[model samples]
Target: MELSSLKFYNVIVLGFAFMLMFTGFQTCGMVEQTVLKSYRNDSIVNGTVTYNGDGYTSLAIIYVVFAFANWLAPSVVSVLGNKFSMVAGGITYTLYLSSFIKPITATLYIGSVLIGFGAADKQRIPLYIGLTSVCALGTALLLILRSHPIQKLEVGDPEEDQPSEEEEETSDEAAMLNDSLDVTHRLSWKLFLTRDMMILSITFFYTGLELTFFSGVYSTCVGATERFGEDSDKLVGLTGIMIGVGEILGGALFGIFGKKTIRYGRDPIVLMGGAIHMVTFLLIFLNIPDLAPLNKTPDSAYITPNTYLAVACGFLLGFADACFNTQCYSIIGTSYPDNSAPAFALFKFEQSLAAAIGFAYSSHLVLKWQLLILVIFAVAGVVAFFVVERKVRSRAEPSGSSYRNI
Candidate 1:
């Protein structure tokens, strides 16, 4: 196969690897609030204490640690190399899943911490129980699959200032043998403080905020609405499926049309995502009760609880999420192609921090208030993204000829 074909093939394989792992982890995460809240407070199982309503706090802890861990991740990955890094990350996830069997506060919290280090997401319990096997298979696949080959950049002379293939392999081996902590820290922080990065951080934070809302808060609210009747828990899972379907469709649409969209830049897509999210928020504000996030509510704010509408909102939420996330990946990949790892680390740090904050407030705030916050961030984020996009484009254009051409 051609090198370009191999490169594309590697990208596809990597994406599927992540999907296999996240499918199980996130499916379980979707219903964590409902399941954990059901545990009787002060109850003992196998002589371990059970605390009710700890799910929000647990999710919060994961993102909190994940935020901090992002800084160290580059160093760790550099030291371990791509293959071993995957192995180590997979192990952390496995350990986290193992903790679920015993169901103790210590195990749960500790598991959260471990998985946070590994960068994990979660779901509903019986589903998690079944999905654990799927996650394990994904982990094993990482071990079985070959590491992706790095494609050299085309800019400048291919031979000039570039190491030979053997030298590159040797350098990679040396990096794995040496500590990269100091270099990783310096590059990550330096890039993070740049004007472009600082502005883009707003969009990153907004992405995380909406992620928490759709993944955890919204699912919980859906389950808590008494108007959904006794099968509300089931509805949460159904909502998750709808969200997944939307995400898949959105991803497919963009992925296929990406070549055509490349000339337009990301601002339009970001604005469209922001608009979709605003609409979703509006639907939530009208259809879901104010107190839905906190507990079961008998009625919605204005409209009667329509299960179809609720699931439809989930679909919209997921579709918008795809737009933002794909743009984020594109932006980071293009803007800092030479320093992509650090750029990604910085993005993850900001995004996870916002997710942590959102989870922290999820249990306290009403659904309407949460929706309001999302709206504010959505507007701010879209505007910030547009500004940065223009700045980047201007920098790419020939400064003197820009006016002459126009």
Candidate 2:
């Protein structure tokens, strides 16, 4: 919030930190594909029957838990503050990851918890500012939990910020009156319900779906490949490597060029990202078809979308997706152009909720119908593209006066 913190070098440092920090967690950004990894490992340890049924349902449950957890994160953070939330995330992550080395049932349950904890990590990414903001907070919270006991942060008395018991009733009455008085709000609900936010939400949702597919589902499938006569943990590891690389490249590209494109405005980058995402989804989805036996030949089976191709898709999306996400956040947080908590809160809420919806839908669809989930992602991509052009930019009426609506 300080002017000095917004300096160019500070911006660069902050951006750099975000990338480095993410490199460690390697955020499952479309990491659902990695489900293939755990599935493979579990099959090896516990045998093949684990892979026989709708194991994909487990992935779906993981996602649903993550979405629900993340949806509640902001409200939790509001009560607990960034400091406590970070601590909680770290503890949850450690517990989740710890389950991996344990018994079969423990691993799945632990991973699910970790996924939910990780969702909070996603929600809090945009709120904190300064150097290495995301990682610093993530590390601080998680590390403290691992290293030390859960002594609560002395975040001042909650009552300090709240109305007294007597005043609470009066405040509630005032809120009721305010609600009754405003039938048609002076501002367009459209401003509050602007197309840009909706567009960003849709695009980000697809991003979430792609992420979950890799991190959650693909790993499961890859792990279970032996059921279909292909067993390669090395292949699964390579998949993990691909995801890490994609996220770093994607984030770095965004940090480097996102601002430069901001002057011409954020719309171009968003649309370009959407188009690329559509192609990427098609490419990945095409892999499934290519895997079909009919597509195979004696000398060399028809190759599915390569890991490199998927990684490249993620990298490009990072570059393009950053513009829309960043612009949308800035618009909501600063639209009022003043110290209005509601303005920023609305923006933060949107980001968290969209992520939740995206994760949930992606998980559910992938379970209900496997590769077909890509079509849903495609539809979201198109929606983002259409919303930006048809609903958003086209509907705007130019005004001579520039008024801050915060």
Score residue 151 of candidate 2 by CA lDDT. Answer: 32
Best by lDDT: 1
Return the lDDT, model 2, position 239: 54
Superposed model 1: Cα runs more than 4 Å off: 1-16, 41-50, 78-81, 117-125, 147-181, 399-406
Candidate 2 C-alpha RMSD relative to the actual structure: 10.2
- Candidate 1 similarity to native, TM-score: 0.83
Cα lDDT tens digits, model 2, 268-297, are: 555666566566555545443322211111
- lDDT score, residue 217, model 1? 90
Q: Estimated TM-score per prediction?
A: 0.83, 0.56
